[model samples]
Target: MQATTPLSANSAATAPRTAQPVAARGRLITDAPTRMFHWLFALSFVGAYLTAEGERWRMLHVTLGYTMAGLLAFRVLYGLFGPRQAGLGLLWRKLGSAPAWLKSLRTAGSLTAVNWRQGQNLLMALAVVALLVMVLPLTLSGYATFNEWGVFPGEDWLAELHEFFGEAMLFVVLGHLALIGGLSVLRRKNQAAPMLTGRVDGPGPSLVPHNRRWLAALLLLAVLAYGAWEWQQSPKGLVPANAWSQVPGGEASGGDDD
Candidate 1:
């Protein structure tokens, strides 16, 4: 190196001058409505489940169930009219894409790239389906018992069917929790915090899409109103030996005794 040389502009530019990190995008992951629904649903489900058998807790259980039903119904409407990413059409399309990808994988053809969002999208769609199934019977059976519409005509299957679906929901909910825990650990992320705080920190390396706000607000309002109305008609009026209550006898008293 006999001659001192000025650095070439290209080389100088290419050199790693102190690495400057990019600022994170605005905190725009989950909106307030979405986050509120998440926690309320969690609380309602747990309270309802724990209070299932006790008369003292029966009112609370019914109230919570009504709240859950209203929330779910509102969610369905919101998903339809919500933000682009939160729309039902987009979510369902993502779910449908999974089967197509699986088929393509079997065919040995060059497959289109599927992003991380696909996995989360599919999981969410499945959870939605599971929830819908669970809620339909829970709500229907509850109404049936309350209104004295026993067996529901030819749909006598509803009684047993409701019990089965309700129990099945427990498994689906557990699976959801496991999936969340696993994803968070694997990605080194705090996925649950966003639902709690209504804001995600960084766009980190994940496919969790953002939610819309207006639709979420509408949903929350609708659910809260419906829940308040339903809670006012708590199941106490229909209390008896029905499955919801603990009748003085070992067995529930209302069903036909043959």
Candidate 2:
């Protein structure tokens, strides 16, 4: 048997050290229900917007509008009763910090020197608050116009008010999207990923302890049931019979408005 010499300290130190591989890092920052609500709310608004102009699509448009109102109601309830991470009070506090951000802006030597992140957060909060505040009036005016309730003094005022709110909502939606895209580019990270994936890359405990997928499922089921019931209520169906006749060539032709 060959006698082996002990390894020197420098040689042992020079040998490549293999550590137990560090696991891929991530933390769940957004919960399932919040993400589901976010997408559903966005889609409801978009569907309503696209169908706003078409007579044949009026029923679908109305359904989507009602969906928005209902979704907002659910969101309000969730924000009020759910975890602290998803609270309206949190939004209000963020909005309350607006004065501080404004004060910072005033003190800054230039616009670029101002806290852009703080300003961006404030703007985002403003857009969200605007959207939430506007939904009730938007839906109410839409309902009035639909039923010819004549809630307003004149025939056209209700319609005009509805249109105005819709446009304002659209403006806020676009701003919200632009802010996300801009921040994503500037930060070299997808700002919207948290909503999309409900997680952010890092080694830390999840900010949201529970995923609350069951709540999201229940919300989805409720929306679907409502939509199905609405469809059943319409005699001609979700796609009105007028849509087929409206096509210049035939039902086969795509003259159907968005």
Candidate 3:
């Protein structure tokens, strides 16, 4: 072996350092179940709204409404007891930080300078809350109206409330789209792509390695079965003629008309 002289301090200090390799993109972030829930919720809401226009589509509307409700229930359960990143605790923490986040936004020099992760978290939390506000009232009012539950002052009143909630939900959906567009532009990334692909551009181990897609399939099948059962149980006519027996003048009017 050749003998080498000891390097001087300045020589060692000025030596070229090996740079660590940059991490590549395509890290899994959102889980398959959550992604399925997101898309199902969107499609069900749209279907319900579209079918709400005519009595001919009333059964379809009711089925879609029930589907939406079931999806929301599943989502709530998942958020409470699901994966680490998809839990309610994390969302709550993000929502709680909104005040500080907004204050920081006032000082942020640009979109790139802002804490995009926290900003995205805050927006997602707000969107969840907003969607709940829209969906809960819509589902409840629609169900009561359809089933003639009589929980409201009148069926007509419940119908009006259902219409109002539907309109409000449309507005909320528009706002949600606008927010997504703005965030996508600001972050210089397609925000919706992760929802579709369950992946994001980052370097990290997947939050969901296996995705447990079978669980999502099972949940979806159960919801569909419940919806089918509900549809079959619903009255085929506008109102079951026998349902009018309790009303004083209803039976008399029907008999006279007959």
Candidate 4:
């Protein structure tokens, strides 16, 4: 019988095939309630701002303002008591390392990394803190003005302060948008899409499990119901009595003949 030839390392038949690694897919990061709060908060701000000028829109404006206040309250509670990823504990921990975090940013190759591990965490914490700072003053001043809550400086002063804070908040929001755009471009990620879809591109297991979407839906429904009820009870002078009635010489016009 002929002896079988042994395969050599150089032989193609004997070489083992190398398996290619699978690419990482997107995973759920933000929860449903958090995402809902984000978009609703944005809409409430915009609605309140756009309706600020006219008496006819004041009801809508006040309703939106109250909505914002409620949203902020919910966020505070949620942050304090919510999930691990969404809780204030994480933010507090990250903030506690502020010095080190800032230092890391200054180091070489921080931003250049293909995956900036802590970038999202840092960004979210900073944004949350800044928004809370801005929104508190804006909300308080608005409420005071609407309710005539205090007699300190006077309603005029309160209104002026409200306007100032509103403008400042707008500026902060613009800055936030600019920063988000820059980071998205640098990181090659769709940062805004995460707020809408509650997911981010990355390897799993996800930081948070499946979201409590039902809670988000309930929260939204409650807010809408409250807004509608408030709309009905809101001052008619502020709520548009009639569209045509508010025209220059229409019945709703209160100007006296000169």
**lDDT for each candidate structure:** 0.66, 0.89, 0.80, 0.80
* Model 2, total clashes: 0
Residue-wise C-alpha lDDT for candidate 1, range 165-235, written one tens digit per residue = 66777778888888778778877886667677655665554333555456557666776676666656755
TM agreement with the true structure for every prediction? 0.63, 0.84, 0.72, 0.75
Q: In lDDT terms, which candidate is top?
A: 2
**Weakest lDDT window of 10 consecutive positions for candidate 1:** 236-245
User: Model 3 shows how many backbone clashes?
Assistant: 0
Question: For model 3, how big is the CA root-mean-square deviation?
Answer: 13.0
Better by lDDT, candidate 4 or 3: 3
Best by TM-score, which number? 2
Could you report the Cα RMSD, in angstroms, for every candidate shown? 10.8, 5.4, 13.0, 8.8
The stretch of ten residues in a row with the least summed lDDT in candidate 3 is: 237-246
Model 3: per-residue Cα lDDT over 59-86, one tens digit each:
7788888788888888888988888877
Please list the residue runs of candidate 2 whose C-alpha ends up more than 4 Å from where it truly belongs after superposition: 1-22, 110-113, 151-154, 241-258
Cα deviation of 132 in candidate 2 (Å)?
1.3
Candidate 4 has which clashing residue pairs, if any? Answer: none
Query: Per-residue alpha-carbon lDDT of model 2 for 95-159, expressed as tens digits?
Result: 99989888987798987888888888888888888989999999999999999885655458888
> lDDT for model 1, on a 0 to 1 scale?
0.66
